[model samples]
Target: MDKASVDYTLYLVTDSTMIPANKTFLDQVSQAIDNGVTLVQLREKSLLTLDFINRAKETLQLCRKKGIPLIINDRVDVALAVDADGVHVGQDDMPATLVRKLIGPDKILGLSCGIPLEMEKAIEEGVVDYVGFGAMFPTKTKKDIKLDRFGQGPIGIRRLLRTLEKHNSSSERKIKCVAIGGINQSNAAKVLYQLNTPTQKVDGLAVVSCIMAAPDAAKATKDLIQIIHTPAPWTQALTITKEEPQSLENKIKTVTAKSPLVHHITNGVVKNFSANVTLAIGASPIMSEFGDEYEEFASTIDNICLVLNIGTPSPEMMNLFKHALQTYNKYGRMILLDPVACGATQARLNVVKELLNYGQVNVIKGNIGEISGILKLTSTYKQANGNEEEVLMKGVDSIAQLNEDDIISTGKQVSKDFKVVVVISGPINYVIHQDRYKSIPGGHPLMGTVTGTGCSLGSTIGSFIGAQADGRNKDKFDVYEAVIGAVELYNKAGREAAEEAKGSGTFMVKFIDKLFENTHNI
Candidate 1:
């Protein structure tokens, strides 16, 4: 098979050890191909050399007949012996340079890479056609898995893709990328979607048990292909349009009319203010940290939105937050995550990462320091000094200094990385969604004097996004526009309230009043 005539999407890596009792391995492979598996990898780690070569030749016949490439995993000799389409080698396997020389330029060459440096060396040698990134989640298939190198999940994969992009900038050929290890129907969509960015994306997914071990491989393959082709509900709903955005008054009118139920699993200090802000925006608020009620709240409620604040990120609270997040994700409900004081403590950073991986988040709102912290979570992020500067915090407030340009760029990167709307709270607030971004430059100095204004802004966003969930506004639901509307309303209200307030105490009251007046005026 020619290397150029390869489709890397939906790669099936065979593992007969896990195959079902009644199922023959070849039948399953054929079934997967009959459905939509575009590539195949024969990976029998324990089979004898003769047995391995025999299996490779048989699989090659099936693959060639189906017009799909068959890759021999970690066995260049077997691949050459059977004249297979490709050989996929791991970091510990024989050198790729030798493998390429043996296979020649016409056949495909794949590599299993977990680190940027490993990929860097491969790109330097110019001996690889594609790379497999992961061991993304925990799996029983590979027992000797190195958790340190392999379990970094999408964070690790993102770093690897950035490395490929860095090389692609000057290289003649763009290398293909495929994510492997523990991918299944449950996570394939999130994995592919989360790993994709505006600049780069994973070319395909490689799986073992999802297709190979299934009792009916065709149905399994069809389900996975369907998921890959269909956009996730939230992702589909948030697609940016070329037309002009709706008027701010009309956006606020949707919120008041729908009054989305904003569920706040937030900190102790901000509960009252967050709820008051929710009410002021004409949304119902339910402040519940009780983990037991999360299912009913997420599954039963209509026109619901979840606002997750990491202010009180105790171990127990984090568990509850994750449960609520997953429940909301299961129902395809909207979520707004406030990583409060995320850069201030290691514990908070850990919690934010956990929440990010646990479920799909529609929006992430934070200050410049917190957003900078989120940017640092990606291994490739670097500042001008080529060192990650610490985000200093006094109590829950960030003393980390970042200019406006830095804030906008940081917000943009975070939005791209997490696949969520990013709102960076600053003097000039910035809201970013995919390729679209807006800079809203209004808000009074007194807004900084308040304690829960930032947290309450999350509540406001929850209200607007909740309205987007309403069937009444189904034709008008645009999360990017809704988030833009929320930030502008909050900032403008802060400016108006600051004009009428005597001090911080009165500014807080007037801010709520302004939210009510402004939202109701529509």
Candidate 2:
């Protein structure tokens, strides 16, 4: 990939639910562009071939108008139908070499290369434009997959950078590589730094959930663009932007300053952990899910931040969620819905969509599998044969087991449709909401080793945003600031907690312990 072609150096990818069916997908893509989205991808995982072709054609026209390239995910036919700038595919979805053949030489072609071996494969193929790596951590978007192959450890990202460096390096084929899965506002800096390796790193970052999951979609896209354009220092100030805050990472400083209270009506597995993580991230947490009191709580709480996480949903719990959604929408409170287990089954994906469509969600967070499900639901692309079968995802974890480009392309599509933030959590968290995007560089793989961690992070961010609503932060930097505060706090605590604990159990305990500790930076 040529450096000049990638203007921002980092890009935001959306999922279908990130937009609504009743809305215009192209319009959503345009909104992100207005916000600073540099590149766009059309992913119609669910729509029929003809429908996907139509939608892609429509979206591609918009992207071209903005001078932003449109990359289609999974289907070469759709890309051709729309005259897309490129197509992104995984190992199983379509071979990179074959995709290049289909698109001809003028268009871009990206492959999913999470492990060093895959990077080698991409090199061997020679037709790939850029390579994507990770499910940085476990995410709600593509729940069932695990990111073992990337093998960065707590510094798995550094390892990924090193591995990518080994393959198609300027010393070799000179291909570009970007990180994906869970790359978001909070962790953008950390991810980029590691990629830079105290040295100029690969081409750029391809993001999903982080950007897609923010309230200010436009700001999210811009932030990520800033991170991509600004390389980190080799020595200190690991911050993505100047500490002055007015710089690109302005949203981040605004977020951590307020210890906002986030209210979550989510699953049992990670509630306490989420609360602790929130506190650590310089926010407060109020976990209340009683159906009867929800409306009352919604009314009384000054900071109305709600997280609808269906980690283990029951009919009754879902009903409560519906009620909560009603309360949130009525009050104009910030709401984030993690479509837990969305893609594993058709019924689940449909329900997730129902919840999102029914609710006024500020952001939608999930993994590749879940995002794919949303695309299948909203877009016209039929889930290609062997696509799901090839996917060996297990739960709502951001850690990836597939290619990175597929994840980012889907994330971008979702972000465009929803007209909100869409985040696909992975190693290098992509936090893109419009032009505002930030890629948090590094945390611990232990993040996923502990269950409910992803859910907790989402809940924590909602709470931080809630503080502004609660009148806790008179300054009220913005919703994106609150999210950054939440993510930073969670990561710092997780990194600290990782010190005392080796396994998941200990990490969970220490994570909570650190979240509650005041000695650390909020």
* Candidate models: Cα lDDT each: 0.83, 0.62
Task: List runs of model 2 lying over 4 Å from the truth.
Answer: 1-259, 380-392, 397-403, 468-478, 516-522
316-405 in candidate 1: lDDT tens per residue?
A: 887788788767876678899999888887667777877786678999998877887788776457423354547556566777787777
Residue 40, model 1, lDDT: 95
> Residues 1-522, candidate 2, lDDT per residue (tens digit)?
333366535566767666544445455566677777767766666899998887777777777777888888888887887677888887678777777778888888887755555666677767877777665545576554434422322134444555556553465546666767666654555465434543336466667655554555567777767755554321121112222333222333344544556778777777877776666655667878777777676676655578888878778887888888767654556778888877676556656755654455666777666666665533223323235433324655433355655656666656544544666666656555544555565458898776787787687567555654211234333444445445555566678888899798888878777766632442
TM-scores of the candidates in the order shown: 0.88, 0.48
Residue pairs of candidate 1 with colliding backbone atoms: none
lDDT of 1 at 400: 73
Q: Which candidate leads the pack in lDDT? A: 1
